[model samples]
Target: MKIVKRILKIVIALIGLLLLTGIITLWLDSSGTNYLKINKNESQFGNSYLIKNVNIIPMNQDTVLVDKMVYIKEGIIKKIADTIEVNGIQIFNGEDKYLTPGLIDMHVHVWDRYELGLYLSNGVTAVRNLWGMPMHLRIKEDAMADNIFSPAFFTTGPKLTGSEFVGDDNLNLSNPSEAKEKVILYKDRGYDFIKTYYGLDKEIFDAVIEQAKISEIDIVAHPSQKVAFSYHLNPQIKSIEHAEEIVQQPLQFDLDVIKLQPIIDSISQSKHTRYSTTITVFNNIYQMMMDDSILDSESLEFMNPLILKVDSENQFNRWFNAKQEDSTTVSRIKKQHDFHITIVKKLHEAGVTIVCGTDAGIGVTLPGFSIHKELAFYKEAGLSNYEILKTATINASQTHSMMSQLGTVEEGKIANLLLVDENPLVTLSTLKNPICVFVKGRKLNRETLDSFNEKAKNRKNLMASTLRYLENLAIGK
Candidate 1:
C-alpha cells in the first residue's frame, strides 16, 4: 500500500512539473519579448494630409480619374475632388503618380511579427492568416491597436484536421461532438474564422459547419480527399483553397477545357464560394523541385535566415532530392501547375470570384514578395491587369466581408493607399515597388519602408526560431 501511494505521488508531481513548463513556454511565446523590434515612425494618427494632382484608379471602376486631389483626416478619406481648401495639412506632390487601393493578400501563414513590415513595404495593406495560435492572437490585437507596423490583420484559429495529422497547433477531432466543441472554443476565443484542413471527415465537416453557423463564425477550408469537391462548395464555406482539389475531380488529366463548364457553373452559382489562387507558391515549389532555382529572385534577399535555413535543409532539399530520383514527379507537378492556371482563367471568365493568395511562408513563397508573383501568374493566365489587380483588392475585401470599409479608394473609407511611379493598370509590375504607402492614414515613405525590409532580413529571433524548429522536428513536419 505504501509503495502504490508513493508511486501515485510521483506521478502527480511529474504532471505538475509538465503543466508548469507548458505555462512558462506559453507565456514566453506570447509575450513578444523575443520578437524582432523595429522602430516605429512617430507619426500621429488623425493628422491631415493632402495629396495633390494624382491619377486615381479607384478600383470601383475600370477608369482613372486624372488630376485629382485627395484629402485625408483622422484615418479616413474626407474628399476626392478637383481641389480641397484646407490649412495646416501636410502636402505631398503626387504629380505624374498613380494612387490605388492598397493590395490585400487573402491567404497567408504568418510565423512571426516581423513579416508584418514586409507585407506593408510591398503594398499589402491587409492579410488573412490561415493558421493561428496564442502568439498570432496577440499579434492581431497589437496590429489592430496600432502597436505594430502591420497590415490590417485578420486570422483564423488553429487548423482543425483529423487525428492522422498530429501537431500541437492542430485540433484533431475524432467525432462530431469534438468538432462542435472545437468550433465553439475558437469562436469564444475571438478567432476571426475557423480553418479546416485536408484530413477532415465529412461527418466532422458537417458538424463544424453547423457549429460555425451557430457561433456566428465563418469557415475556410481545403477540400478533404474523403469528400467530394461538391461537398465543400456549400454556401457556408467562404472559400476553397488550392487548385489541386478542383483539378483532381474530373479524373481525366487532359480533358478539354470545355468539359469543365459544369464545374465552373456550379461554383459561380454558389454565390458565397470564392476561390483562392495560390498558383505562385505551387510554381515556386515546381521550380525548386526541378532544380531550376535555389530560391525565387524576389524572395532571395528578404527571407529570414533561420526560416530559409530550415526550409532549405528540410522541405526544399528533401523535395528536390526526391524529384531527382523520379523525373516523372517533376512532369506531374508541371502539368498540375498548367491545369491550375487554366482553371483560374476559366473561373474568372465564368464570373466566379477569385481572391489573390500566395500561401506565403511555406516552402519558397516569401511573405511580402510572393503576392506580386501571384499577381503576375494571374496575368499570365490571361487576366487583364485590371482584373488581376481586383483579385487582390476588391475581390479580397469582398471575400473577407470587409467591403463596406475597404476595397476602394473613396471618401469615408479607411485611408490605405499606395502611390506608384507608373499606372498599375497598365503595368502590374509597378505594384512590386511602391513610392510610399499610407497604412491607416499614416504614411511610410520609401526610406522608412526600406528600413523595415532591412530590419526584417537581418533581425533573426533565435529563441523563437529555435522553438519552432524543435516543434517541427518533433512532429516530423
Candidate 2:
C-alpha cells in the first residue's frame, strides 16, 4: 500500500508539472505578438470608398470595363459606373490600373495566423481550408470580426480518416454510426463542409456522404483509396482535390495511358462537379527528388514552425534521404509530371471547371507565391490567361455558393477586389504582387502587405500552436 501511494504521488506530480509547462508556453507565445494586428494602414476610407478611373476586369466575363468609377459603401460594392460623384467617403484615383475580383484558392491547409496573411498578400481573398480543426473555426470568427487580417475563411471539420491514424490532422472513425454522428456534430459546430480522406473504407465513406446529404451540408472529396475512383463521383461531392490524386487514388498509380481516357471521360461527364489543380504538390515532389540541396532552400523559412515541428516524421528529410533516386520520379512513381500537365489540359478541353489551388501548407508549396507557378502550368496546358484567372475567381466562387456575395466586381456584392499594375490577361505574372487588395472592405496597401509578408517569414509561437493543434484533434468528440 505504501508503494502504491508513492507511485500515485509521482504520477500526480508529473501531471501538474506538464500543466504548468503548457501555461508557460502559451504565455510566451502570446508575448510581443503585435504582428497579428494587420490593419495599421492609414485609412481615410473606413470601409467605404470611391475609386475613379479604374479599368475593371469584373471576371464575370472575359471583357474589361475601361475608365470606370466604383463606389463601395460599408464593405459592399454599391455601383460600378462610367462616371460617379460621391461625398463624405474617401476617393482613390485608380490611375488606369487593372482591378479584378480577389483570387480564391479552392483548396488549402491553413495552420496558423501567419498563413492567413500569406494568402492575402498573394491576392487570395478567400480560401477553403481542407483539414480543419476547432482552431480554424476560431480563426474564421476572428477574421470576420476583423480581429485578424485574413481572407474570407471557410473550413471543413477534421478529416474523416477511418481506420487509419495518419497525422495531427486526422479523426479516425471506422464505425459507420460514428461517421454519421461526426457529420452532424461538425455541422452543428458551424464547419462549412465535411472532408473525406484516403483511408476511409466504403462503409464509412457511404455513411459520411448519406449524413452530409441528410444534414444538407457539403462534401469535398480528396479521393478514398479503399474505394474506386468512380465512388467519389457522387452528386453530393462538390469538388475533387489534386489532379495528382486522380493518379494516386483513382488510377491506383497505374501509368497506362490507354486506361486514362475512360476515366477522363467519366470525370468529364460529371459536369456539376468542380476540380482543383494542385500540380504544385507533385512538382514539389519532383524537385525534392531531383535537387540535392532543395530541402534547405530559403523559401521554406516562411513555413509555419508548428507544421514544421508537428510533421516530425519530416516528409522533406524522408524524400531527400531516400536510398532510391526520388520516389516521385516517373521511373518509380509511374506517370511523369508532363503527363499530369496533359491530364489538366484534357480536363480543360472537356469543359470541366478547373479551380486554382496549391496544397501550400506542406512541403515547399510556398503559400502566397506558388499559385503563380500553378497558373504557369495551366498556361502550358493551353488555358488562356482569362480562363486561368477564372479558375481562381468566378469559377472558384461557384464551387461554394459564394457567387452571390463575391466572385465579381458588380453592384450589390461584397467588395473583394485586387488592383494590379498590369493587365493580368496579358501577363499572369501581375497577380504575383498586387498593388493593393481589399478584404471585405478593409484595404491592405503595398507597404502594409509587405509588413504582413515579413511577419509571416518569422516563425512565431511554436509551442503554443503545437499545443493548440493537439487540443484541436478532439473537436468532434
| Structural similarity to truth (TM-score) of each candidate | 0.87, 0.92
- TM-score, predicted candidate 1 vs. hidden true structure: 0.87
Please provide, for model 1 over 48-97, each residue's C-alpha lDDT reduced to its tens digit, 9 standing for 90 to 100: 68999899999989999999999988678999999888988788889869
Scored against the true structure, residue 75 in model 1 reaches a CA lDDT of: 73
| lDDT of the candidates, in the order given | 0.80, 0.82
Compute the lDDT for candidate 2.
Answer: 0.82
Q: Which one wins on lDDT?
A: 2
Which residue pairs clash in candidate 1?
none
Q: lDDT (0-100) at residue 240 of candidate 2?
A: 87
Task: Kindly report which residue stretches of model 1 are placed more than 4 angstroms away from their true locations once superposed.
Answer: 1-47, 249-259, 292-301, 468-477
